[model samples]
Target: MTPHNELRLLPWSGPDGKPCFLSTDNTNGHLSRLADNTEAIQLDLATELLDYASVLLNGAETDSEELRALATDLTEALRDTLRVAESRGHRLPPPHTDTHADDTDSPTLPAAAFG
Candidate 1:
């Protein structure tokens, strides 16, 4: 089990040694008693998709109302998905060995705005 400030990443290996991920943290304590971890992974994918959509919207030359609406929909969907995951006792994955982590247990984001 890997834990971040408020996020935790738990990787589970199947009988065949294949791997998958689970999230366990304050926001997802409800899922701690659940028997499966698929719900969390699904929510993570939805979040990732929303991230991509954010990038697309940010880089677009024309932020049409349709695009804005689509982005809003995706954001709302992501929020709902996260809520469900939490209700199911799951959470978003904690930062792994990725550069996102500051090589410490403290909170670290993608940038170093303040010390």
Candidate 2:
């Protein structure tokens, strides 16, 4: 059995907007394939929406109703994209950490660097 941390985050939600997860060792299984395809479709749709939004926004005669609809669609697409990112992030291998480094040996960056 896969560990809890290793469980796959499914692309779709469950009842009441709860997240859904899949626990399996087979990457090529039916559910995995389905989720993969769904993610691909979602990404494609988001790309197409970006193009449409650019065109719509560039038009001088754009209407309020059309802008509102575009905003709604963009919101949904952003949500899906975030979910996909979270799912894939969890699946990535944990970053390597060094425990033996001396505190004094660490380099410090200026506060302005962060900005």
Candidate 3:
């Protein structure tokens, strides 16, 4: 069994909207593969939605009703994408840091880099 902190965060929620986790040493296990496939599908759908949104927003005759629906879909996609990101992030190895270096010595990106 893996340590509590090292458990894999599954891509979906449990009953009553609680988070679900998996603990296994095998990377190619059944649940791991399922999570991987689900994440891929979610990301692909989000990408498709983004393209559709761009086209819809650029149209002159787009109606308020359609925009509201699009907003709802986008919100759901964003939520799923965030969950997938959190799950995968937990599975990544920890970053290495130098003990001799001060926090101020660390590199930083400009604000524009985020955009």
lDDT of 1 by residue, 1-115 (tens): 4333333323333588654344444444654434245445656767787787778768857558868777787876665475555543534345455433446656555566755
Q: Which residue window of length 10 is worst by lDDT in model 1?
A: 2-11
Per-residue CA lDDT of model 2 for 34-85, tens digit only, reads 9999999999999999999999998889888999999999999999999999
Per-prediction TM-score to the true structure, in the order listed: 0.32, 0.79, 0.78
Off by over 4 Å in 1: 1-38, 88-115
For candidate 1, list the clashing residue pairs, or say none. 30-89, 31-89
Model 2 is weakest, by summed lDDT over 10 consecutive residues, at 96-105
| Tens-digit per-residue lDDT, 1-115, candidate 3 | 3333468888788988998888888878999899889889999999999999999999889888999999999999999999998887777667666554455657766899999
Candidate 2 accuracy as lDDT: 0.88
- Write out the backbone clash pairs for model 3: none
